[model samples]
Target: MQLCAPVGCPYFRGMASVVVEFSAQEPERLARWWADVLGWHLDTRSGTVVQPTGPGVPLRFVVSARAKARKNGVHLDLRSESHDDQNTIVERLFNAGARFADIDQSSDVPWVVMADVEGNELCVLEPRKVYADTGPVAAVVIDTSDPRSDARTMATATGMELAGERSEFASLRPPSGEGPFLEFLESESGPEGMLRVLVE
Candidate 1:
């Protein structure tokens, strides 16, 4: 997702986690899908149906008529405790309306790529030590035209520490150096829109 243009919002620019709102033909349906998958409650009281997940931004889905053109540049990477857990979760996701995503990855790929009810891409990763402490979500990755600049902007805005930076990629973690990370990688014309943001 693109960096938010925070101006006259109610909360301070850096004080709040960036809310990830998706444009969906059926906001309610999409919201329900995520809520079911994440086991979180959906809040539709304030217009958008939201499912807040920990310190990260609340996942919100807004009603839109326009359909998405391609796979998103930003997607969720869900971690598993073991191979069995991964298979279980993948089965649950498909049962709940998720479908296999043909991302050109062969059967040897370690992660399970799937699309949400509205075709938003997400990966169920096999358990690894790196994500042992990051909780269920491993990280939020964004493909950017300029990786370093976008990473710097996000680090400054969120007070996240820069873990690494390069022309092709950059990574950031919270000030305390815990939880999920926000990563940026160089690419041509990344998908544009704000869907979900990793906030702490």
Candidate 2:
């Protein structure tokens, strides 16, 4: 289960690199949507890519014949600077084809859940001190049956530090400690269309 570092990983150890890829029916459109959302530049020269704006991993979208059929196992949680900014981001997303997602989250939760144009769920979270330095994206969360084990595997493979762990979630951050955290969340649902860390 070992993975080498990728070119853009902030803490790359020069072994290999990592990237998060999306399989989309319309790769270009999906890539554009994400690029706009993350304020990243879209690079279509090689493929539909959302180039990393910081130390965060780059996102690449490729064509897929099948459409999304269920909730995604992987999703992004966007960080907001303030309450007003959170509201503004949600509003902008809605105008760009995002819709509210009902994932059984509590009504009192501080985050707003919404699905992207392609039915991928994402969270726009209220400001939190812990994520203040995590750039635009707060975390790349994966739903797993065993959060601790998965988190450990990912942390080891990617040279990330095990940042936190609780009953239902385990989190990791790169050695540099500034990019988005990789969080494994406890869930009963099996993995569906999910994030992949490709090491080359």
Candidate 3:
């Protein structure tokens, strides 16, 4: 398929531009839950929103009556500045209604797997310098059969710069002075797991 780079494409990669979108059958409820958790702005009657912080990205919630088809192949990997911070945040998330999700993950992993109220999964990771200066929403990642091919489509469609590329993986991020990245990876095995994202 021919990829599209929208009109005014250059500016669409701005930090304040739409960075991510979530779909929900009960949009108001799910959106509100996350908004509160993230300290984002919430308007239950409309799309979920989060005011940009510094060069952070903006997020939105869209209405969708359809049930999730399967576990998401894309998910959020949240960053932490320290192990203590990671533990505290995980504890807070548990108190706020997030629960550990056993996605065939081992207990020794550096990241904790947890599911939102609606069963969407997310990870809270130990501090890594790459994300040390990024926002609470660090990166959006997905699995693909071919990172190079997928990166091309993503780059053409969103105007995000091709930040990095290698044999097994590729990443796209908003241009300099913009926001976080959107990554694509070619798994040793094909994708089949717990991660989902709504991009439309």
Candidate 4:
């Protein structure tokens, strides 16, 4: 389906889009809550939640029937440019009702995990230098119904080319090699999705 642009949206243009589909029994309620939390809008008519970051940066949420089983295999990892900045953002998120995840980072790792209002776990990491100098921090495994189909849609929407595909999985690398490699895996359990992003 062709996406219609929202009038006067600040970020209505971009070359990258990230779409995460979550399975919720009460799709409307969940979507509404997330829309408010993320400062996005909801198209209740279509039952799709979307946040347009820019012309190309589209963050979408799709609802399904699967119950949230366990911690997400793929979690969004956000990073800040500096410690002070990270702390500030973390505090803000916490105050805004985000729950903390028990991820110890005293060992020199760059990131920490936290849970969203719905108990969906996400990570907040340090600067890219930590990963660049220290190597990969973690791998995200995306659980989906049809990984190949989802991967293809993402590839088409984000202008990212599919590097490879396995029996029931597909891999996508962001435009910049700096971002994490996103792998899509087929799951019968339901739509438990994850994503990673650079905060600042």
> Largest TM-score belongs to which candidate?
2
Could you tell me the lDDT of residue 106 within candidate 2? 99
lDDT of 3 at 156: 70
Query: Model 1: runs farther than 4 Å from truth?
Result: 1-14, 53-55, 193-200
Report the lDDT tens digits of candidate 3 across residue range 1-200.
12222211122444223345566777678777777666656643434655454445555566666766666667777778899999998998899899998878887999999988777778898887766545676677777789888887777765567878998889877766344567787865444443333333
Q: List the residue pairs that clash in candidate 4.
A: 11-54, 12-54, 12-55, 13-54, 13-55, 13-56, 14-55, 14-56
Superposed on all Cα atoms, model 1 deviates from the true structure by an RMSD in Å of 3.8
lDDT head-to-head 1 vs 3, winner: 1
Candidate 1's C-alpha lDDT? 0.71
Q: Give the top-scoring candidate (lDDT).
A: 2
Model 1 quality (TM-score): 0.83
Clashes of each: 1, 6, 4, 8
Model 3 clashing residue pairs (backbone): 72-195, 72-196, 73-195, 74-195
Question: Each prediction's Cα RMSD?
Answer: 3.8, 2.2, 4.1, 7.9
- The digit string of per-residue lDDT tens for model 2 on 171-197 reads 987777677888888999844673454
Backbone clashes in model 1, listed as residue pairs: 20-195
Model 2: residue 178 alpha-carbon error in angstroms? 1.1
As a whole number from 0 to 100, the lDDT of residue 132 in candidate 2 is 73
How do the residues 1-200 of candidate 1 rate in per-residue lDDT, one tens digit apiece?
Answer: 34554422122234535555678888888888887787766887776555434433356677776787776778778878999999999999999999999867799989999988888888999888766755566777787898889888877777767888887999876664446667787878574643545333
Give lDDT tens digits, candidate 4, residues 1-200.
12333322222123443444555565566566556544455765544555432221223455555656576656655545677866765776687678777634365555666777667776666665533421122223466788888778767765555766987898776554434445687777534343332111
